[model samples]
Target chain A: MKGVGPTTPAASQPPLLEKEGRSSRGAVRAEVLLWLAQRASAAVLGIAVLIHLATMSYAVRGGISAAEILARTRGSLGWLLFYGVFVLAVAVHVPIGLRTIAQEWAGWRGAGLDVIVVAIAFALLALGWRAVWAVCA
Target chain B: MNRAWRARNHPAYWAFLVHRLSGLALAVFLPAHFLVLGQALRGEAGLEGALRWTDSPLVKVAEIAIVVLLAAHLTGGVRMLALEFLPWRDWQKSLAALAAGATVLFGLAFALALVGGG
Candidate 1:
């Protein structure tokens, strides 16, 4: 510690490790889990998006009636499951996306970040489910 | 300078270039898609008219090509992101290859589905 005096450049810089305190293990775990969720949701989106696009192209070009499309979708466990998973992925994916946006654009974090993102997720879920129900039911 | 150049010219760099191009392509297609669909909200004649436009061979080929490009860009992006952010750097090459292969196979399948099978 002799050479690491106050005047030394390294000493003047903030310590990478605080002398007595560190982030809790739980915080580190939470950060890692968020990272994993973002990655997994992205993978889901990649596949879902393609299917969504292909289906859109077909439905539009094939001149399928809304009634016909609904007939295919309604009470079909498969469509429900697919879009259900799509909504869930959006829920997880959008929050993590907003995390970056909040950090960069709003310089925000902590509880405020979690609250706003959760609200977006819920809104997406409610709206998405309503639409799905109208068509599928 | 040579080290910097090598990094800039890496396969990762090429992938980044392709992703940006494909994203731009998708952005261009999105508005056109919406406009076409907007026809549906007008009435049945408008909706069928939109379909008539879509059924053109040129439009079919263009749309299918865009889908393929978008798939390539998306899966390639995820592969790059995983390589950079995940703790699985060793598998980056293999994973990238897998993503590329999957994109080609799936894109073709979906394209064929567009024409109601090959």
Candidate 2:
């Protein structure tokens, strides 16, 4: 929001005052909710990632094949739930992180950027859940 | 340049850099990972082909790197959560060290596991 492009100054108003009014309450609320969701998802991901890492490391130690992995994961309701939650958390997490990075690094901000990120989040959820289904369902 | 060098020497700064870099790397990797796993929807043959390709030594090394990145990001994230939710304290400075140590430990464990160490 800081580096958003130049604004037109009204005849009676100062430039800084015009810029300050650009940030709508809805945008602020949405930004706050996005921040909160990222933090909450981060907490869930902290535990989920540990379990994922440990399990994958253990599995790979014995040199697991794809068929073998499928055999274990396929039709397991527990794994389905585990990975489903993982994918969901990732969906909620990554886009928000990327949004911040885009703002800082790419100078991309505002509703257009927000829309793109939400689209990305949905794409992640779809792809991730599809993978989870392929592996576990 | 002096300022940059001085910043690099700080543990908190290093942690911040590592967290940001690792996170960016993981974000870049995620799309590719999802695309590959999309092969799973094509049934066993497609998924198995992708899995077999990952069996190559190069990919194995990359996998280890990914795990290291993941560990670093995870510990870094935990440190952030603590900073946000926990009460302020002098001990917070030590979190960077703790995160680095934990990341290293995870990397070591994964490397050893891959080598078939007990």
Candidate 3:
């Protein structure tokens, strides 16, 4: 029942997914979803940033030591998951947004873009996890 | 000459300009953030002293302004994406106008609340 419009060559033909590229309409839908994902992740990161900033101010004002902060974070599921999602969103969202700029500015696409994006994602993940470890471990 | 003014009037054009401006502002502020927090690596007094510096009204004002810029940048970015990617081009102009109004309103509300509280 998928993609069975008037363009169907015959009943015996393969499904659209078996084809090389996603259908034009399907590609547009995917792009729209990607845009939404990027925007939603940005909003999530914004809220997280506000919370992080306010808490940092409060912590310093209360004279909480670094060790004390670490003590609070250690083994805390809430902090772990909050930062984990933060890192994940940054990894996914930043590279995808950068890919657009790269395509427009550097004329890079396809495998080149994929490789750069993956590299950026892993780099961000590594840096983020390192900081998280310093605080949470 | 006229073309330049016309481009400036375009909502998308202004949004792009604001995004770049906000990005620069954030980039500058982020270094100061790291430096202030780096005081924690020293001792409690050092960290506390850095925070006392933050209690200055000037820093508070700058922070509030940055928050306003961030909100405007974000709202504009969202509107740009909607106009570019969505199937609702006919409503883009009206939606863009609404977004601009929301940006100003929300930015002011947030800045006033946070800065006043700070």
Candidate 4:
């Protein structure tokens, strides 16, 4: 919006764009917040996913059995906490990622889409915690 | 001018595509995974039933595929974070290649573990 002096006006300018511009930026603030959350959760997940992959890759040596998995996970408070945080991070990370994908691929936007994303976030949280509770409780 | 294909035909775009597709695949699998894990609530029989279901040859393939997708997504995510935070450099361009390579290794290691275990 700068450099629009009498002599410096070099291109076609939309009339009365100042207020609209401010409002648009304000609207983008929500998107900025979502982006921030996604990044933070990604950092958490980077560590968590690596740990998870390593554990699984190394632990399963002669086939997987429910009994062995249960022996390791059942009643383990530490595993519970580890998975709890992992679930929470996934809950935050997946929905935001999906929202972006929806926007880019499906051309879907607006409050309706946001509401659906929120629903997905809650579902992930509930389902994830439920799994944790099953193992830990 | 078919500019879209040209624009997307690069290492970065391939990286982006793999990341997004893997993410989508994982998301689709999440609920089923949660449900299966939650079977622990029903004790050994319940958990055993789910394990038995996954004993099929196809499910084994799917398991491997899921591991590969997860590795791809995880490595791609790390690349994305580095790209966003680190200073730009020519070497940084190779991060995508490195991530892809690492993903293959993860998939291979997971596959080996599964084979040895199974």
Give the per-residue Cα lDDT of candidate 2 at B110.
93
Tens digit per residue, CA lDDT, model 3, B77-102: 67666666688657756766776786
Clashing pairs in 1: none
TM-score of 2: 0.87
TM-score of model number 3: 0.56
Off by over 4 Å in 1: A1-27, A42-64, A98-120, B1-5, B14-66, B77-94, B115-118
lDDT for residue B103 in candidate 4, whole number 0-100? 99
Highest DockQ: which candidate? 4
Better of 1 and 2 by TM-score: 2
TM-score of 1: 0.54
Per-residue lDDT for A1-137 in model 3, tens only?
Answer: 87587666753455654563456667678668867887777767667755665564445443335555656676788887887777676666666677666676679877667787778768766666655544444
The sequence of per-residue lDDT tens digits that candidate 2 reaches over residues A1-137 is 54344453444466666677665665688889999999999988998999998988788776756787788888999999999999999999999999998999899978799899999999989989988998888
Pairwise TM-score winner, candidates 1 and 4? 4
Runs of candidate 2 with Cα error greater than 4 angstroms are A1-23, B4-9
TM-score, candidate 4, is 0.89
**Sort by TM-score, top down from the best:** 4, 2, 3, 1
Candidate with better DockQ, 1 vs 4: 4
lDDT of 4 by residue, A102-132 (tens): 9999999998999999999999999999998
User: Residue B37 deviation, candidate 4, in Å?
Assistant: 0.4
